[model samples]
Target: MKFYGIVVFLAFAAFAQGVPHNGRTKRSISDNLETLVESIQALASEVNEDLGIPAFDPFTDDSVAISINQTLAKLEGELTDLNIDGLSDFSIDTLKFTLIGLKFTFAFTWPNITFSTGYSIDGTVASILPIYGDGKASGEITNLAVSGTVAISVKNSYLYLKSMSSAVSLDDLDIQLSGLLNNDDASALIAAVISDTVPQILVDFQDVISDTVNTAVTEYVDDYLGSMTLAELLALIGS
Candidate 1:
C-alpha cells in the first residue's frame, strides 16, 4: 500500500477467506473492506490536491488555468523537439489533457461482485494521449487494468477472491480459509492476499496508471524537479 496521502490505487476484499472468528471483535469483514478501500481512495484525492498541477478550473479560479496551460504548452514543445517517435502532435488541445488531472473516480457494482474503477483525465476536449504530466517532467506507461471479485462464506463475513477465470466455487475456498485463521493482521493480510492474487494484467494496469498519473502530477507541480538541467540550476545558483 503506497500511503503518501492521496493520488493512489488500491483494491481489496473484506472476508476472512475461511478463518473462523466466531464472535466479532475490532471490525467485521465488511468493515475492514470498507476501511481499506476508502483509505486508498482518500489517499488518491489527497495526493492529487497536494501535488497535481491544477488544470483549467471551471470553479472561478482562472489563475489555475493560465498557469498550467503555459506550463503544459512549454512541455509539449520540449517533447516535440526531443524527436520522440510515436508521440502524437503537440498542441494545446492535446496538452490540455496533460494539463488536466486524471480524476480518481470509482464505482462498485454489487450485483456482479466486480469492483470496477478507472482514472479519467477530464478536460473540455476528447480523450486522447492522456498522460499524467505537469509543466516540468513527464513519463508514460502502458497496459493498465483493474478488477477484483468476491466470494462470501456460508457464515457471511468470511470472504475471498475468486481467482478462477470462471466463477470461483465454494469448495476451493474452504480448503484455503482453514489455515488462514489465527493469523496476524489477518484482515488486512487477507485482503492483500486476494488483491495479490489478481492476475498480473489487472494489477499492472491499476499500479501503472496510478504511478503514471502521480508522476504527471509531480512533474507538473514543480516539487520533484530534481532533474532540472544544470544550466537551469546554474541560473538559480548565480542568483
Candidate 2:
C-alpha cells in the first residue's frame, strides 16, 4: 500500500518537472512518461523487497466478535481469530494494479485492488442454546476473494488512501464443532450459524477496518516520503 502511493507521487513529480518550459527542449514528453512508468514499477518491486512482503504470506485477525440471530441458529460469540497462510494465491499481479492508472494523466483516479485466498477460523460462542452450550467451532472458508476501489487524495500536502467501496465473495464455508455440541451433523449446524452471522459481523466493523487501513497507509507513506526532498526527488527522476 505504501509503495502504491509512492508510485503516484513519483509519477507526479516526474511529470511536473519534466514538462517543457521552452520550445527548444529536445526531449519528448512521451519519453519521460514512459520512463516514469518503468521507474515506478522498478521502485515498487524494490520496496516490496525492503518491506519483506513475501509472494505468499499469512494474514491474521485475533479480535473479532459477532452477534447472530437467524431462524436456523441464534448465537452470540466472537470470531475468536483466524489465520490463513499462502495468501499469494490472493495476490493481485503488480501489473494489474499498476497498469490501470500508471499514466501521468490518470494520477487522480484511484486504482482497483483485488485479493483471493482461503482462511480458517475459530468461533467461540458464549451462548448458542438448543443445539449446545458454551463451545468453540473451527472452520475454513475457501476460495475467498475481495475486490474494491481505493480513493487517494492529497490534503495539506499529505496523501491519504481511503476505501470508498468494497465487495467480498467466497466459494465454500465449512465448519466443525466440539465441546458439548459435537455430533455427526455438527459441521452443518456450525456452517448455518456462521453463514447467518458473518455478514453482519463484517457490516458492523466496516468502518473500523477502513480506518485501520488508512492509518497504516498514512504511517507507511509518511515514513517512506519524509526523508525525501524536492531536489532528491528530481534527481531520482532524472537519474
Candidate 3:
C-alpha cells in the first residue's frame, strides 16, 4: 500500500540535476520527464538502496495486527503476531505525466503486486466455521492504478506543494487465508468468501485510502521541495 516507487520517482524529478549529464541536444520538458521515468524503471533497486529505502521485492514487517468483525456475514477474527512480506514486488505497467504550469498530475499503474503474511487468527469466520489457528495469508492485486495531482506554488521564493488530490483503483484481487480452520473444506470456503469480499471492502474504504495516500505523499514530497528554491529546481531539471 506504500507508493514508495512513486516517492522515488518524484525525488528524482526534483533533484535530477545532481545526476551527471552527457553533452546532448537540449531536450523538451516532456522528453526529460520520459528520461526520468526510464531511469526509475531501469535502476529502481539501485536508487532505492542509495536513498535508504528498503527494496520491496520482499519487504518484511513483523509487527502487524488486525481485528476483523463483519456483522452481516457473522464473522469475527483477530490476527496477531503477523509477519508480512513481498510488499514491494510490483511492476509498473504505465506512468504518464501531465504538466500544466505549476500543476503536475501523475497517472500510474502497477500491474502485479503480491504479498504474504503469517498470523494467528482467533475467531469465527462464519456463523458455523471456527477460525482459530496459526495460518498464512497471501494475496495478489492486479492492475492497481493511482492518479495524483499536485499543485505547486512559490512561497517566500521557495517551491511548496500547495494542494494535492488522489484516486486509487484495481482490476482484480485474489486472497487465500489458509490453515485457520481444522477442516480443509472450511478453510477453502472461508478463503473464497474473503477473496470475494475484499475488493468490496477496499471500494468502501477508497476515500480513506486516498486521503491517507495524499497526506503522506504531500508531506514527503514537500519536505524535499521546500528545501530547494524554484531556481534550484529548474536548474536541476535543465541539467
- Once fitted onto the true fold, the runs of candidate 3 whose alpha carbons sit more than 4 angstroms away are 1-10, 17-26, 47-54, 62-101, 119-134, 179-190, 200-204
For residues 166-218, write the lDDT of model 3, one tens digit per residue.
Answer: 88887787887767665656777878877777667668777766676677777
lDDT tens digits by residue: candidate 2, 130-227? 54433455556665555455444444554344333444545555555544354536646666777567656555665554454455455654554455
Candidate 3 lDDT: 0.61
Considering lDDT, which of the candidate structures 1 and 2 is the better prediction for this target? Answer: 2
Candidate 3 lDDT score at position 106: 72
lDDT of 1 at 63: 20
Using TM-score as the measure, which candidate wins? 3
- C-alpha-based local distance difference test score of model 1: 0.25
Q: Model 1 reaches what TM-score against the true structure? A: 0.18
Candidate 2: RMSD to truth: 10.2
For all candidates in order, the CA lDDT equals 0.25, 0.43, 0.61
Error of 3 at 237 (Å): 2.5
